[model samples]
Target: MNNTLKVSKYLFRDFKNALLIFYGIILAIAVLMAALFLNVISQESGNASFGGFGFSAFIFLFVSGLNCFKANFKFLQANNISRKRFYYANIITLLSISAFMALIDASMTKVLKLIMPYEDIVEQLYKNDLFFSSFIWSFALFTLAASAGWCITMLYYKCDKLMKTIISFAPVLLVILLVMLNNVTEGALGISIIKSLTVVLGFTNNNPYTAALSFLVATAGVLGLCYLLIRRIAIKD
Candidate 1:
């Protein structure tokens, strides 16, 4: 088999085994949440609501992608694949999963709309001015999370257990620090800094192209750092 085909097959097999299991659990939780929220909406507004459940499901799938990446990385290494091929395969697999999950989310929203008598909730979701923006943000967040997982896996591959534990928690700590700063500054400093930086970079108008370019640059920089670290520090057993 050719290298691409080999990687593709390996990617598919691992994804089938791991992603499916995680997806099934997520689907079940989503359905249950939808059912429960439907009752609450019906009681409060005399109409069923599926929005909460749908949103929860979406969040679950986004979070689950990290676990999928971790599982796939271990499987690829066990199967004797090179780290480069493993990384490429992981990126491909993650994109495919994200696309599929997005489609599923859309489909569920449609189905919920059909079953529920409440047009108000559905209309709010479909017609909100920030709907598209929120969708794009969700996609960006997923990419960030997946990339973070890959980076953590690399750290684990390169470092001792103690080092891996510290490295793994670094992102969490950074997030906490950001939240604390935001709270302390009453959210002004962070927002001002981001806006100022965006304006300086000529991205203040929120052009989709510019935002996408920024995202690509940031993702590339992260992946590059991961590559360098893994190349230099990874233990080849």
Candidate 2:
């Protein structure tokens, strides 16, 4: 628990300045965009919905991945911290920050309702349950994304140049294969894989709860891989 506290404190201090600047820049841009959108479009008949989880997920992914690179990893290694502790601490930070962002995003609906008069996209889904369920849903998604991002960076960090190069092209290769397969054969292979995964993960189209559960498992797997990578990671790695 002390290690957890230490890691959290370290993260707070480590990224405080950058985080503030990033948030300020995002807020300023958002305000400008909202103002422009409001001025240009009539609110009464506006199909435009403002205030939903937009940049939070991507920001978490980017920030966490960036922070978990050589510098932080080396620092933790120098401190003689166990990989397990380090990983859990980062997980705590991930959940905490993600939840905070989710709360703010959810509150934006109320704030935007005063300015723009249309049913917000996120708010519509949580009409029956409101803040609690919505926050859980959003938090799960952002955490999963962040964990996946961290896992990817870890993969890169632990890899040699050749491996990194191969990994870099992996996404493009996957996409190309998908495209080629589609062209060559009218394939439900991808869809079948997805369906199989959903079944394995207990995800159901009608049940957001099940989807959230699926994401929880996915997040755990990603973060677990990240942890395993760090277990034997060297200082520079």
Best by TM-score: 2
> Local distance difference test, per candidate?
0.57, 0.68
Report the C-alpha lDDT of model 2 over 67-154, residue by residue, as the tens digit.
6556766787788877777777888877777777667665664565567653433345434336565566667777887788778888
Residue pairs clashing in model 1 are: none
Q: In the order shown, what is each candidate's alpha-carbon RMSD?
A: 5.5, 3.4
TM-score of candidate 1 on Cα atoms, chains taken together: 0.63
Residue 237 miss distance in model 2 (angstroms): 7.5
Error of 2 at 229 (Å): 0.8
lDDT of 1 by residue, 175-219 (tens): 999889999999987998788768643355644334444555666
